[model samples]
Target: MNATAQPLVRFRGVGKSYDGVTPVVEGLDLDIQEGEFLSLLGPSGSGKTTCLMMLAGFESPSKGEIWLGDTLLNTTPPHKRNIGMVFQNYALFPHMSVAENVAYPLTVRRVDRAAKAEAVKRALDMVRMNEFADRLPKSLSGGQQQRIALARALVFNPRLVLMDEPLGALDKRLREHMQIELKDLHRTLGLTFVYVTHDQSEALTMSDRVAVFDNGRIQQIDRVDSLYETPSNGVVANFVGDNNVFVGRLISVQDGRAEVGLPDGERIFGQMVGAARVGDTVRACVRPERMTLCTRSGFDGGTPSLNTMHARTAGTLYFGDHVRVRFAVNQQEGGFVKVPLDDESLTEWSAGDELMLKFDERHLRIFA
Candidate 1:
């Protein structure tokens, strides 16, 4: 994120409110870099869709300015914005053929018949929908219809494309395949994309960066790896992946580590994440995969460090590639350790078995 690099789309203090009192998007300041795929990811009604609508010029901002390059887009109409849009339902014209649907954008702009045909052919080819040119919307499958919708968006050669859960209508397998295809298309065309979705995994798979929205505000914005590995807050940590939270009082803070006193007179050390002081209540969060589990006999009972925990196995869950072993520590539901499927210990574990869970201090994040 170079300070001087110009953004393709800029939202400056943007806010959107439908009822004039309750805002859907509040004070959103974001930058979509040139040729970057940025996803607005959140649960339903989290303002991600509203942000996309605002950027697409379908909905005007209640406050702040939106800029596409140097032009102010707050006053621009949707048709004049030179932006492509794809919706969850495909939004194809039922009466039109696939080719005709792809050419609809060009037709709206009064493109000549010859040039519109050429653009339609090229767009259809790009989406691998060329052979379906003669097919009507009703005759095509959901995936094929989505391809036609994408072709229509790209036919007009727009610099930016906004997609609102475009893959929502497809089955899981098709949606995954289309995610790769969409990423490839974005790379080939070098077009900026603003995608909206409630699916966290989809956002992580397709976007160069993700902005996570919650309660009409952005919770965090970062690359997928950063968001998963080092979430800025507990909300992000819990939302992005499986996190084990231990709420305790801070006993000490020194260097880059803090000590948290658990309920059962146990103090654990973890990497200091946010501002906290002695006597402050805090949460030490760790991901399931970071924890290593072993039988109690394998580990000597020594002075507790940030990395060690004693627990009893509650149960185990098989996820094909991995095993999640649930544990009960200090009377809390505590957390689970993720063991790889290849590990033979996964099958040996039983409920009520005492175990020691170990993790590196660096993997634990402390937040107030």
Candidate 2:
């Protein structure tokens, strides 16, 4: 997104509380760019759903302000917000036909018959559910009903769409298929989307940017790649993907990098995150895919072993396309290296094999 682009939605110091004393969402300030897919992702009770509810006007904010374009939305009712919503249970009326369900929003707005019919047709076509216009929602399969719900949300031409785990009820394969479909639809329609989900993989797969929430606070908000590759903290690193983390004392901090000392007196270097003192006990993290497993010979004379560590193979597990080799670094089994199936040379290792784990210094991240 362009930095200069004006945000279509803004949350300034937004907070939510049901019991008056405890907050579910706290001091949130976020700007969502127009036509971008932004996901509120976190575990349950982490305040992501509350944020969505506040924006959708289903729940009022206890403090702060929410703006849609230039309009203040704190006191606006849901129907007047011009925002479409889709939920996990499909929320379809069993008595209403698909077309009728899709036309409900337009009906509430008193749209003329001809225009409502045209919009209903276009929305059905967008979701490829034109043939099911006459079918009752109860007769439709889970995926079909989800499509109809989506079409209904779009039929009225809402300014923004909010989805809260709309695919949670579907089977795994169907859910994956819908993720792709939703992303493609978002790109084609170019509409602002705010999604709330607890599944990290689902958020990563569908969102252009993700706002990670925990304990009623947004820990980090950034592009998906940045969130995964360079997470802002330990919570995000562990939540977004497979991260190998170890506790170490910060030995030195120079320029943006740091030298860390392990309990066994071995030292490694990496880029430092946040500020840290020389003696501060810090966390060092690296992704599983970034570690390279090599035998002793591979790191001898030619390789100077700048970012190398001595590790013993704890175990190796196979997962169809790739194998994960767990390593005991400094007598602690914490790090792992992922090896592709086609790499035969790296697969013939036993649990007790003495090996070396090498990685680029830039791949390591130190968190204070």
TM-score of each: 0.96, 0.95
Model 1, 39-155: lDDT tens per residue? Answer: 999989999999999989889999999999898999999988999999989989999999988988888899999999999999999999899999899999998999889999989
Per-residue lDDT, model 2, residue 292, is: 79
Cα lDDT, all candidates: 0.89, 0.90
Cα lDDT tens digits, model 2, 1-368, are: 56587899999999999999999999999999989999999999999999998999989999999999999999999999999999878899999999999999999999999999999999999999999999999899999999999999899889999999999999999999999999999999999999999999999999999999999999999999999999988888878888777788999998988999988888888889888899999888889998877787666622432577788888888898899998887745467889998897665688878888777778888999
Top candidate when judged by lDDT against the true structure: 2
Off by over 4 Å in 1: 1-4, 300-306
Clash count, candidate 2 = 0
**Cα-based lDDT at residue 351, candidate 1:** 92
Model 2 misplaced stretches (Cα beyond 4 Å): 301-305, 331-333
Worst 10 residues of 2 by lDDT: 297-306
